[model samples]
Target: MIDADDVRRIALSLPETVEKEAWRMPTFRVAGRMYLTVPDDETSIAVRCPRHEREELMAAEPEKFWVPPHEASSAWVRVRLAALEDLAELRDVVVDSWRQAAPDRLREAHPALVPGAEAAGGR
Candidate 1:
């Protein structure tokens, strides 16, 4: 199962990503925009998930995802580390969130990191 360290490793691996601690938790950001956070002692991770897809994701994987009350109005979801299927899934989630927060320039430069792009290759 993925743990806080795994989260740290995966997040920092993203282009232009950085990790900072706030409120006693690790938050991951791309180009100064936060995209992921490990809270509650790193038991789970909060990641960007557009409002349109958040509900469906939670419904489809109730055991793996949820929205913290404070973040309900925001486009974000929390994932239970212990529920993640594997490292590949974690990487996909992290990369997706990174794409959402990454600036246009960063995303464009890292075309392979983006899901659908002319330069798309592999991360």
Candidate 2:
């Protein structure tokens, strides 16, 4: 099953990614902007997600995605690690959040990491 360690591994694999402590938890950042955070219990992750997409994701899969009341106004969503399908799904989700926080130059330099890049022949 995908776990906190898997999250860390996939996040760190991204270009220019770094791990930092915030709110007493581990937060993954790119370009100094936080994109992923593993909460205290390490069972869930808060990731950068546009409000619109976040709502749709939660509505589509409430078991896998949600947001705490305090973070409702933020563009972020909490994902349950156990609900994730596999490591590939975890990588996809983490990479998507990383893309949101990554600078344009970094994204451009790492096209293979971008979602759907493989189908577009990036890899």
Best by lDDT: 2
Best by TM-score: 2
TM-score of 2: 0.93
What lDDT would each prediction earn against the true structure? Answer: 0.84, 0.87
lDDT for 72 (candidate 1): 94
TM-score (all chains, Cα) for each model: 0.90, 0.93
In the range 1-123, model 2's lDDT, one tens digit per residue, is 878999998788788889999889999999899999999699999999999999999999999999999999999999999998877778788889988999999988977876534322532
Model 2 Cα displacement at 34 (Å)?
0.5
Give the Cα RMSD of candidate 2.
Answer: 2.4
The 10-residue segment of model 1 with minimum total lDDT is 114-123
Write down the lDDT that model 1 would get.
Answer: 0.84
Q: Residues 1-123, candidate 1: write the lDDT tens digits.
A: 688888888789888889988788789998889999988867899999998899999999999999988999999999998898887778788888999998898877877885332222544
